[model samples]
Target: MMQLKWEKEGYIVSDDKTLLQMGKIEAWISGAYWAAGRSREIIEKSIQHSLCFGMYDKDGRQIGFARVITDQAVFSWIMDVIIDQEFRGKGLGKKLVECIISHPDIVHTKMGLATKDAHGLYRQFDFEMDECMRRPLL
Candidate 1:
């Protein structure tokens, strides 16, 4: 698959795996409310398989991350979006989402995500809450 990238004011959003900081990403998601206790192996495997976006500051440090599990034609589930604590209020998260949803490979696919408190942010991009049913296997 072709990698996608976007840049603004020295910050870059890209699907390039070489730009991903695995340690930082594992640290963030492993401590996140949704995936607390997740293992490094699991995180690594997920990143290896998913379409991922990494946001880097001008200094080339990874500051934000998002991933989409998709077939590139029909369905996508956005997951693990996070911005570094110091970078939270600068709209980097929004840029990350935009880069994911607007990518040509999956832009027209049906996209979905679950968030406890980011409804307002997703709403700005026209995402609506929908009733969903789940069956836990564990």
Candidate 2:
């Protein structure tokens, strides 16, 4: 099984399958999509093309999450990173992204993500937007 070790907290990140895990990840992240009124179908469809990880506290309760979509070769886009409100400000976001960024499975691909206010959070992992613009570029 694929696993990620967080030595500081001594927890393992794995492929989450339980309903509790699914619910926890969904609950913490759904609000951003909801506030934008994104449909449930979009979220579910996104999950299929992505890799997801759930972070656990010392007691092993799910507390954080992140995901990525990639072609496993040239590029990837990280998405939906969040720690519960209670879990913020403790560096868990850093740890969670650390786990995802350094995962053995995805190390070879170029990574990217879209975020509004968390630019500071992702910068620590070397994520940034390119000057390359994709549009009718006026």
What TM-score goes with each of the models?
A: 0.97, 0.78
Off by over 4 Å in 2: 10-12, 17-20, 33-35, 39-41, 132-138
Model 1 regions more than 4 Å off: none
lDDT tens digits, residues 1-138, model 2?
A: 355556575645554534127666656666765224445566666666677777776788887777788776777777888888897898888888888877777777898776778889888877777765546526
Q: How many clashes does the backbone of model 1 have?
A: 0
Local accuracy by lDDT, each model: 0.92, 0.70
Question: RMSD in angstroms, candidate 2?
Answer: 3.6
lDDT of 1 by residue, 79-118 (tens): 9999999999888888889899899889999999999989
